[model samples]
Target: LGDLAARRFAGGDRAGALAAVEEGLRYGGQAAGHAPEYARWYARGLINQGVWLAWPLSDEVRLPRYPLGPRAGSGPSAMERAAGERALDLTRAAVEVWAALDQRDPVNRRGLAQAKVFLGDRLAELGSAEEAVAWAVDAEGGFRHLLRAAPGAEEAQEAEEALDHIGRQLELRLRFLSFDSLVSLRARGLLPEPLLPQAVVAARIQGVAEPEIAGGLRLDAEQVRTMLEVTPWLAVWRFEVRGPDGLWNVQGHPSHGATEVRNRTAEDIGNELIRGFTASADCPGEGAPWRLLLWWHEEGDPAGARFRAAGGPDTAPEGTADTPS
Candidate 1:
């Protein structure tokens, strides 16, 4: 059943893979109820299910490698948050089962150690940094003990590689604070808004130049420099979301939700924006074009008038001075 699940996952049928593991776990539990030896199968099934739920939240899955901050637009979706919590719970259960099995028979020690490593990674994702490091250290110690007991074994080499991987993950965790931690600090008023501290750390992690950071964020170069220098010294213990505002609410933004727009002509897009404002009674429909034109100028996009008037035969307008008057 586990093999079937793996094949389904590799074939890109994620929903099918998840369903297979869930069914496999149910069957494993039924078998374990009838026989003590089948408990190992149930435990293994738990680990597999937990991994599938957690995989999308892992560093291996996310792009651009910005663990310290939410991306430019939205933070993790609600589904991602739910999956991370479920993964942590399932992995913790698996660790308990593996520990009991190892106590009964030392041959199960390898499984116990590996599960610990996985649990540590989940903890790290959910913003339990210290606990995550502690679990990794404990797993490393277990692997080292196994290597000492079975010198020159194939599993010994695998344990060494696991140790190296754990070390690298720990180093990364130490060097950069997690996204959850930064959000928590902002909630407590320790960090101010409009200049997201997480963005500063992310820029540093990606080796972005200070001047570039300032330009992108529209901040003074010295402010960017100070944030880059001061952020690393702050300590973080846990990840907490205090309110809806803490999450990236991209609901009414142009990029997400029911009213999202894409692949439309500039005139159509501008009309949509004007309709939205007029519907809210913020501006009269007749005055929308000139008001939008003024806003674009204020935002330093003088050529935005082209976007506002771009439905005619020649869609492209000549210069920044071109307005809808």
Candidate 2:
């Protein structure tokens, strides 16, 4: 049944594939009750169904990245979010079953490791980077032990590739500066006006209350809360600033810089900040000495429906851009 579902998925019949896996699990459950050997098959069926539901929504998952690109179609649909959550639950169950089976039969150890890797991938896609890395490390250790136990096994090459992928992902994750750090930078005046919106978003994501965010960023608490409430699809696509030298300091990059701003209310607030800054007598004559670039989109817009706004000396003329610097 698992094989049948796989074939259907490979043939581009995702709905059919999911349906087959669901049916298979029902029969597998009955079989597993009487024949314990069928338990592994049942677990595999669960994983197949989970993968089918989750893989299509992978584009919606946001990871920390430098010069971050726009998300797909304003963000994940309700159906996609539901499917992703269900997938996470199913993969967790499969991992538990595999772990239990591996305890009694060592042969199932390989299955357990594979399931862990799958679980890790799902977690990473769903924005649990730390947990994902933990599972990946555990799975890599298992694969390494397997390689040592059988030096010439066919799976050795696959294990090496998995190890390499895990290492690369871990390195990327390590380079990401936390949102908390970004907020601190803003507090110190290291970040410019354009990034203020992103800083507010970051603060909220980090569990800071609306009032604290308002006080810290010098924004109105009611306005901040209203913006957040109205713009459920708003997100930072990039968070970076470029100094006089023209070199970008991207936020998620190892250099610790940040970009991207979203939402109309947020944009209005950011514009007010830019206007206030530029109007100040202390404002630098070289146009504030930095350029901030941000990409944003409204809900229901196409993926390519992005508008760029630059704050500082390099900004386009007032009427030519989405927002004035």
Candidate 3:
């Protein structure tokens, strides 16, 4: 039952898998305490609980604590800081025990790689990106072997799929580890606008008095209104970006999220910007000459209407990416 629960839980059926763990706890309570077989199952239950909570689930909120900070309480507390530390300890402990078991048991060696990836991931969450990268790489290698050994086998496919997901982990970690963010973006070309930075831009656009376009800027309502007439697709909506720090609506104290936008300038995500113009799309101006606004948004404070130039893209990476997350 314990192994079954772990399997189910790993496969994404949390409620069913969790129920199995509960049963294992009830049925194998004494046996797990005494027998070797039960011991593995018992340890697995704890590990499964940890992994389940870690995996994405609706409303589950994956431990919601940053790696550094004070404890919430002598136990878990009224404050968020103490709770973060407690959660970290539990996550680390579960992953560690699982590592010890698989290392000691050669029979489970095939599954070791995946476990390593999980360990690296949990460790990464705890702010150890180096270890996280190592474990993920190991897991990627394990999946490769599983794929080759089984060729057409379902396990091979599973291993390959798991490898695919780790790519995102690597993406998130790139922010901290020394990496060329612009190179990555340039390689992708037609990028997703580095969502966070794009959000900041949108929020800034939203903050300005739409009417203010009349004076501080060259384009007045008459021109902008007329421009809108030519381009029907020019609907301006304000966007709020969420940063590593938290929800940032453009108007907030400095944060890592703010940095995301600040970096997107030519350095990070590449200076991808609004096209040469935002022409009007309306009647009378139908298919008329396009007007160029040359507007660009970059990261940082006093953050409205400022953008760094990105000389054209570095050239498309030469191939297609699976999809932008």
TM for every model, in the order presented, reads 0.52, 0.53, 0.40
Order of quality (lDDT): 2, 1, 3
List, residue by residue over 174-239, the lDDT tens digit for candidate 3.
Answer: 333322222233234312222223222222223333244333233355743443233211121122
lDDT of each: 0.56, 0.57, 0.40
As a TM-score, model 1 comes out at: 0.52
Candidate 2 vs candidate 3, lDDT winner: 2
lDDT, candidate 1, residue 204?
Answer: 42
lDDT tens readout by residue for model 1, 1-325: 7899999999988788899999988888788656546877888888888878877766554321223222212334679868878988989988887787635354578788888988878877765654665677678778878887865667877889998887766555443333343333334443334335445554443335567656655568887777766654221111111233444211223221122222222344445554554454333233212233211111222322233221112233211222111
- Model 1 residue runs over 4 Å out of place are 33-37, 59-74, 177-325
Model 2 pairs in collision: 238-259, 238-260, 239-258, 239-259, 240-258, 240-259, 250-257, 251-257, 251-258
lDDT of 2 by residue, 1-325 (tens): 6788889999999998898899999998787656547888888887878888887655444332111112333455568767877998999988887887745344577778888878877776665654665676677777777777764556778777877776665543322224444445446544445345555554553345678777777678786776566533332333345656877544343212223333333344334434544454534435544332323322222232122334556554231122110
**Model 2 segments beyond 4 Å from truth?**
33-36, 59-74, 104-106, 175-325
Candidate 2 global CA lDDT score? 0.57
Best candidate per lDDT, number? 2
